[model samples]
Target chain A: GAGVSQSPSNKVTEKGKDVELRCDPISGHTALYWYRQSLGQGLEFLIYFQGNSAPDKSGLPSDRFSAERTGGSVSTLTIQRTQQEDSAVYLCASSRPGSNEKLFFGSGTQLSVL
Target chain B: SQQGEEDPQALSIQEGENATMNCSYKTSINNLQWYRQNSGRGLVHLILIRSNEREKHSGRLRVTLDTSKKSSSLLITASRAADTASYFCATDVRRDKIIFGKGTRLHILP
Candidate 1:
């Protein structure tokens, strides 16, 4: 892929509905990241996957939020029983190991929980 | 939670003027990067300054890093309306865990 790709660019789900957002990182990029951001606000780290290592989950806000990255290429962020607070843009970024925070970002998924 | 804190949460300037934003982090960093986001989505990498480097420049953008203070600043010279966007500063803690600040919302008035 030329750049990171995110699916269902915009989504509106009723409160309590479960929704899944997907991300396909650049080819051969071994690192993938998920972040949550309110409109015009800073990014909130959600989770990160680096190669085959156990993902760093310290940033998950609650039990309702979970994510998985399979095959080290595509990653999914799942929000269960979504609440209105879950409404925000979910961004995905990828970088190679030791890139020193040089991240390539996707456009993002705007998830609106009504 | 975000480790970096950007100052002047929002800034507005007329076109042709300059815009400066600062970011402060709490820990040792491998490097610091600045990114821009338009319409609140899609981040465009602007520049990165390694811990050992003090300053770097790219086009109209100038970045300065001070490891002693754990701070960095981005200066956009001769700003334009196209520069209107949210500017973010990010730092890497380890292999690939890059943490970001909320960002400074910059609006260039035409």
Candidate 2:
């Protein structure tokens, strides 16, 4: 793809249900990131992947949240037990190696846990 | 935790006036970049300043970085209605990942 692509654009789920958001990064980009933004709030770092390196999960809010990058092209973020507080817009971004400063972002998936 | 803190949570100014937002970070960084978000969607990268650079300009945007103070400022010249959006500053804290601030919401009064 010419730019980062995210799936579903919007997802509405009941509390305690699980949800999965997907992201397709720009081709050949070696770095991908996931961020969460609550209503009228700053973005919260969730996870990061650089090449084949072990993902940096220091930012994941809880064990319920997990992500995987398959074949270094697509990524998925799964929230095991959704809570109302989990409602937020999940963003995905990618950048070329050594160009982490310049990121290309996807439109994001707006998750609403009711 | 957020690596940067943007000043003035929100600002309202006339369309032709210039708007300036400041960001302060706590640790050494590889670089600092600014982005714009509209309607709470994805953000668009505006400019980036490496730790070694002090100032950079792009079109009507000017960015300044002060490593000693661990701060950066973004100035939008001749702001337009289209510039009414949220501005964020992101820092590469460890050269591995980027973290963004709470952002400054800019509203241009027509």
Candidate 3:
């Protein structure tokens, strides 16, 4: 793809339901990241992936949140037993190695747990 | 906790005026990057300043880094209506990951 791509631009799920968000990073990019943003708030880092390995998962809020990247191309973020507090926009970004810190972002998935 | 923190949660300025946003980080960083988000969507990378470098420029955008103070600033010269967006600063504290701050909402008055 020309840029990072995320699926289901918007999602509305009930509390206790499970939700899966997806991210497709640009071709040949070696690094990927996941972030969450609540209404009018700053971004909260959730995870980072180099190739297919996630070296930093310290940012995941709880055990209910987990993510995995496969084939070094697409990634999935799964939230189990979602709560109202899970409502937020999940953003994904990818960067090429040696690009310093330049990141290309996807539009993001807006998840609303009611 | 976020490694970087942006100041001035919100700012409104007239078009053609210069707008500046500042970011402060808690630890040493390899580099600092500035991004712009429109309508709360995905962000676009604007500029980056390496820790060893003090300043950099990209067209109308100017970025400065102060490792001694652990701070950075983004300046948009002759801002335009289209320049209205939220600006974010991200720090590459760890070589493998980057953390972002809340961001500053910049509104350009027509």
Task: Report DockQ per prediction, comma-separated.
Answer: 0.81, 0.86, 0.77
Identify the candidate with maximal lDDT. Answer: 2
Q: What is the C-alpha lDDT profile of model 1 across B4-36, one tens digit per residue?
A: 999989999999999999999998988899999
Over the stretch B4-50, how does candidate 2's per-residue lDDT look in tens digits? 99998999999999999999999999889999999999899999999
Task: Give the per-residue Cα lDDT of candidate 1 at B11.
Answer: 98
User: What stretches of model 3 exceed 4 Å from their correct place?
Assistant: A98-100
Query: Measured with DockQ on alpha carbons, how good is candidate 2?
Result: 0.86
RMSD of each: 1.1, 0.9, 0.9
lDDT of 2 by residue, A63-95 (tens): 999999878789999999899999999999999
lDDT of 1 by residue, A75-108 (tens): 8899999999999999999987656456899999
- Candidate 3 has a DockQ of 0.77
TM-score of each: 0.96, 0.98, 0.98
True contacts kept of each: 0.85, 0.79, 0.70
Clash number for candidate 3: 1
Residue B103 local lDDT, model 1? 94
Give per-residue lDDT, candidate 3, residue B41: 83
Which ten contiguous residues of candidate 3 chain A have the minimum total lDDT? A95-104
Error of 1 at A32 (Å): 0.2
